[model samples]
Target chain A: MTTGEPGACVLGVDSGGSGLRAALVVPRELRRPDPVRSPEPVRTGPRGIDAAHFMAQLLPMARGLLEKAGGGHITAVAVGAAGLATLGDDLRAELPSALAKALGVRRTALAADAVTAYAGALGDRPGAVVAAGTGMIAIGTDLTAWHRADGWGHLLGDCGGGAWIGRAGLEAAMRAHDGRRGGSRALLARAEAVFGPPAGLPGQLYPRTDRPAVLASFAPDVAACAADDPVADGILRAAARHIAEAAAAVCPSTETSADTSADTCEVAFTGGLFRLGEPLLAPLREEVAAQLPHARPVPAAGDPLDGALHIAAEIAAGRLRLPLDSRMLSVHGEGVTS
Target chain B: MTTGEPGACVLGVDSGGSGLRAALVVPRELRRPDPVRSPEPVRTGPRGIDAAHFMAQLLPMARGLLEKAGGGHITAVAVGAAGLATLGDDLRAELPSALAKALGVRRTALAADAVTAYAGALGDRPGAVVAAGTGMIAIGTDLTAWHRADGWGHLLGDCGGGAWIGRAGLEAAMRAHDGRRGGSRALLARAEAVFGPPAGLPGQLYPRTDRPAVLASFAPDVAACAADDPVADGILRAAARHIAEAAAAVCPSTETSADTSADTCEVAFTGGLFRLGEPLLAPLREEVAAQLPHARPVPAAGDPLDGALHIAAEIAAGRLRLPLDSRMLSVHGEGVTS
Candidate 1:
């Protein structure tokens, strides 16, 4: 119900580490314009993702994009937030009414960034996608159900993720400093250069609110030292194995899916972690090949923002095939049926 | 310095989890009374252990104990602080002057609890002692120098400590919850019983300042499940291996020590972690035996407070033989010539 071309379109919003992005897309269109983006990441609190903070950032970006595109009826809206699974309650509860009131949007899909990564990677297909950055998560669908692995945060899981590798590398550095076994001289040198002396790392790290991000910052250092350091190399290899384990854990097995019609599914990798190149990816590829023989690795088609756009368009077209998961992926409002 | 029956005694203070304790100890005496105790763990801050909070707890307690002991010359003071190795700067810089001003103390030994445990276990003799509680550390002496391993706090190290076992057990529980490989149903049951649900464990942890202690609290649950759960058993065994590794790393090797006269040395295990009993200690013993064959395992002679007393006694008698280490153990008084 806008002033533009009376054509059906949907709004997509993604909130993640870098910032917030909102895009409008026409369903079934071959080409789409660049999304309006804001560099401010939404804040999270005890209540979860701050719904008010999110709207404060989103409304302007959405309106700006909509006005520029001369938008028509925004049939549905979907938002993908980084911590939607564990910390999205505030957003999930408040976003629908807020969106409908602000933009006359009735249909809303609140999806975890990993779920959006999955949709964007495989397009409602029965497959798995791993989005690994400071933290890592794998989401796979069997069409009827979704399987998830890791994303348990740096302490519990997120194994083989950026934080994990950095922690391992730093541990090796500390070991070297302590003259203990498993110490890596090269890694130790890198650690000293990056974080100052190994002795101060715990004090510098443990007290921080952004510990995961801080730990992940060192992952690249670990990767950089792999060529000359066995300890660093071993850390990367172990990370690869762990990542593969998560992938294998979540990928739909041929013998164990509601729809066993497909024996294999395409697996995709996304996120900043993969940018470390072959030091991490090469072993990751080997591990994935060894662990999930039935799955093939593929390049990710888009990012979480694009995934949000895709989900919104699917909802608008009444062709959203992804099963609704209460926490992982959910649809709100009675105005939409798919 | 005290109005007692012409005897030499020292004030030994232990600042740890349970609380603060001060004892007027007559070194080399076979019999000793219980230490005056205050149920207050000293606070830590950006500058490290709050020197003010520490003296507030120690001053009255030390005075009362000295008065109770019928007034004797407080020959020396040795404070074994739990975080002395890393967070002891304020305590080191401030405690000497504070103790001198308050208690007429001159000699002071500021030691990490691990060093205190080592002294309590092996005295000033050459050997290694593993102190594993919520965290773990191994300290050894070759007469001329001290060797430290692990004790890098839970994030970087403290492998095989209570926190490590608990974290591993919880990881298994999460694995079971996610239906992933390496799942432990027994651990899952225990985790849910203790932490409510495997899903909520991350939120329950990660945010707290006392994360290590909270993680370690689950160690007993893990220990209880070890008898029936291979996963739990494996976690403990791995912890044992890590502990052994640390011990091995720090224990003086016949081939590497400056003083190679001793063919073998005594090794002792200390702390609440050892109280987990055979479920953990049995494997730990096996791992230690395998790794530190040259060092014979021995029961600790006393607790850390006793160790503090011992260090104070040594300092007072001018017989302190533990090599000075800037962080591990530091002597901070000109009157001390040991």
Candidate 2:
């Protein structure tokens, strides 16, 4: 059901390095804001972005979202982003203002992708949400606040993410080169085919700079390699452990307590990485269960976009709150927190 | 490094699924044989068996020559093996009647891991040797044969080594149970904490098996997933191309051709799968050149046993022969002509 005319149309945006996405949430009770009813996703170049540049890309998308809403009166906008976003009055303001200006909202609430995702899934409740995309971040919410662990990215960390698996696959290739390991030749050849001559590998690393998708594209190769190849299997296993670790780290801050085995909020996962399904999720679920014996795992109802829309609805109703509890409101969508 | 009386030395035997290998060669040489003084390698495996497994393992300790020297003249023994060498074959049929009976010999030939290694590194000659340790094979020759290229195993393919990289890795983890495209959290958790459970994962997978190490043990991970992680950088770049392909597909009758380019056998590499070398010797060397261009990638001296020894003296005598063209031979290793 639409928030009704002059209906409070709220915009939700998820900005990533590759592109910026904006959705017009009209408060649907069944499923997410309709994809067909929504505006076509706007495409934008990833480079040359710092504040102003970020705004330029987002504003147009915001306008598109508005246009696609069939001229409804927009009340407010909420943005969930890949980078850090903390809202406060002092210096080192964490809330993402770059997106705020584009949305034309002075009071744009902000949260890290992890927190927003948890908000989207659990609705500001005490639960854990794992964002398994090109990168990985696990967010957990308790009664008062939220907590996180393991969002280090491809290089420093990011155990069970698309990027980590892809990078690991490439490393296996190099190990093969040095004669220290073994694997299928097809994997490396594919890497070379995609990245370019192995000789000039270093120079080719940053051709696109801000684009994580370039590297994320290799995740399938890692999954494929892991299926039959021991080396690839190891990489996937490591990624699972990393993601599980993040989930575990946040469990303490969730409804689960160290004193008792019962968890306050069940765990949930979102994004493409989780879509890898059994190979990754089964092990990950097992690992998480082993670590937090009392914690229960629930499949994510929808993606970050879906979560974003829920948050927009909450904001529109002035019911927006942090670390939502199940009692706060009803969730209506596929894979919503139980 | 002689261990006993001249006529009472232990034999070194290297039996592979491929063939039978025996050497009156002493066990001391199996650990650290004096290459300069080692005897030439011999081959007497069954029809299906060839130098691949038999030669790869035993030749290192100079088994062939000692066999020709006779086992009655030897004492204690050391041995290496492959496949069911540990269980399958009935000793009565697999071994020669005389040797199996041990009528006159104090000890029969032992496992020829050294010899097997030598075959890959030194082939029939003598010199430096290395290996990727998987189905991928890479042999090179200076005076003897040195080997490299994803060795023939599993499928008729090579890009890098590490059987698990493509087929084996995926199979081990069962492709993370994603129905052709996914990841396994359990497998990933097990692999990440190969040494022990990292701070985050639960201990469930640990109970199932020593999965972490088992999965990590595969080489393909190094090649496929290490691009972003320094731990796997060189590993991903490793593995060079093979000089030949099996067309006729007959036992030993397979016609082989080398992709001899501007860089012929003048520079090459040999191993199970090179750590940082992959796809082709050309691109691998080129990658190496990214750091040290002029550095010649001379083929491995031999498979490490008497491979180089077998050919070193022959080359010195200007009569060392190769089944493939000299240029192709230079690129790969001295081939065993039927």
Best by lDDT: 1
- Best candidate, DockQ-wise? 1
RMSD of 2: 19.4
Q: What are the Cα lDDT values of the candidates?
A: 0.84, 0.46
lDDT for B173 in candidate 2 is 28
Looking at model 1 chain B, report the run of 10 residues with the lowest lDDT sum. Answer: B1-10
Question: Quick one: RMSD of model 1?
Answer: 2.8
Every model: iRMSD: 1.4, 13.2
Instruction: State the displacement of the C-alpha of residue B186, model 2, in Å, after optimal TM-score superposition.
Output: 28
lDDT of 2 by residue, A171-214 (tens): 55644543433444656676777776543443344334533455
Q: Native contacts recovered by candidate 2, as a share?
A: 0.00
Scored by TM against the true chain B, the candidates give 0.93, 0.31
lDDT tens string, model 2, B1-338?
34434444444344543344444434334443432222333343443223333334443444445555454343333234342222223322333233323323322222223334544443433222334444443333333333333332322233344542433333322223221123334444334544243321222222233332333354555444444433343333443322221100110111222322323223334544554344334455555445323334455554433332332223322343432222122211123221
Error of 2 at B292 (Å): 27
